[model samples]
Target: MIQKSIFYTSILLIVVFISSGFKPYDNQIDKWFDLDNTDEALYIFPSQKNTDYTYLNAPFKGKFFVGYKEAIGFKESQNKYRKVNTLGYMGKYQFGAETLKSIGISDSLHFLNNPRLQEKAFVTLLSRNKFILQDYINKYEGKVISNIKITESGILAAAHLGGAGSVIKFFKSNGERRVKDEYGTSVRSYLKEFAGYETKNIPAIKNAKI
Candidate 1:
């Protein structure tokens, strides 16, 4: 009786393993290559997509951009806008260096110029009980973090290292401004793939220890 039970259990385990096959736990490569019909392709592959969402997402999520234009006459111009956006996820936080690079962002951009974005993301993650930026800070051994200013245009952020030379300027304008917004478009795309990967592969990788 014992031998028969052992054989049945072994067969069941073999069947389960064979059915599962080789599922990708971290399919960042696959997700990167598969460009969807959303703004994520643009932000992640700006060169390939030749797109910028800095304007669109800025307003709803409260973002603005500061720029200057030449005056047609003998008058000065003064206008400034900030772009804002928000993205939500339903699972674990799993962003990293390779993923950032795959999306056309480098360590300099991720670690340096994107502090505000990261912090806001961290806050959002905390709200959802998904992950914590403190975990990254702990793992990375105390990286620099800067406090950001919040306004109607959203949260202003910068890194001490790469953002040193960056500046925001105001200009006066005599006419109304009209332009299309596409900043938050990519937020949807990013969330889709990000959530998909988190839901699909994260468990397998976590459970591989046994």
Candidate 2:
């Protein structure tokens, strides 16, 4: 009688546990490669995209890569070739000195003075950032959270404002932990503001340099 009672109790517990619907927590970490990428977590772009697609009227250019960069340029420095912000960020795209050096641009003056080099620097940074955030893109792209649609272009633009880490945090929190710059700009804003541009073509190159 005792053995039968214990067996019935065991069966009852098992059924209750199975019906609870308990499962493992899902996150980006489980989806990434198994490598100690701590050093890569520190890296950090953008134009301020508002309702100003008419900033260029080059026949559907607003939706292309060209329009995307220009809108960002206008937002950064109002399209000024030699713009240097009070915070010491340089050029039309408002690149910080350290970030410029990461892409092989050391001479701050030369970078500010050369429009071609600055343009090259912008694209190179985009390619590298896209590479770093590729997995995030793969996971979050087309998923709407907080009523905002996610896309590769928006991911890169947000990474431009904050680093890839901030973006990862945003996704890990399911869009709850939005980081911000001193200018009161949030990562989520960039993600939403710059969505649906032609940045899918930017090559995902590791260590991309100008």
User: What is the overall TM-score of model 2 with all chains considered together?
Assistant: 0.70
Score each candidate by Cα lDDT. 0.25, 0.83
lDDT tens string, model 1, 72-156? 0001111111212132111112224433333334443343345454433323322222121223213322221122121211101
**Which candidate comes out best when scored by TM-score?**
2
Q: Residue 48, candidate 2: how far off, in angstroms? A: 30
Q: Give the TM-score of each candidate.
A: 0.14, 0.70
| Model 1 steric clash total | 26
> What TM-score should be assigned to candidate 1?
0.14
Residue 119 lDDT (model 2) = 92
- Give the Å shift of residue 31 in candidate 2: 68
What is the Å distance of residue 84 in model 1 from its true position?
18
Q: Write the per-residue lDDT of candidate 2 for residues 1-210, one digit (tens) a residue.
A: 999999999999999999898865442223233347453332111224555234553224577899889877876787788998888988988999989888888999999999999899999999989889899899889999777899998899888877778888899988888589767789888889789999877899998997
Worst 10 residues of 2 by lDDT: 39-48
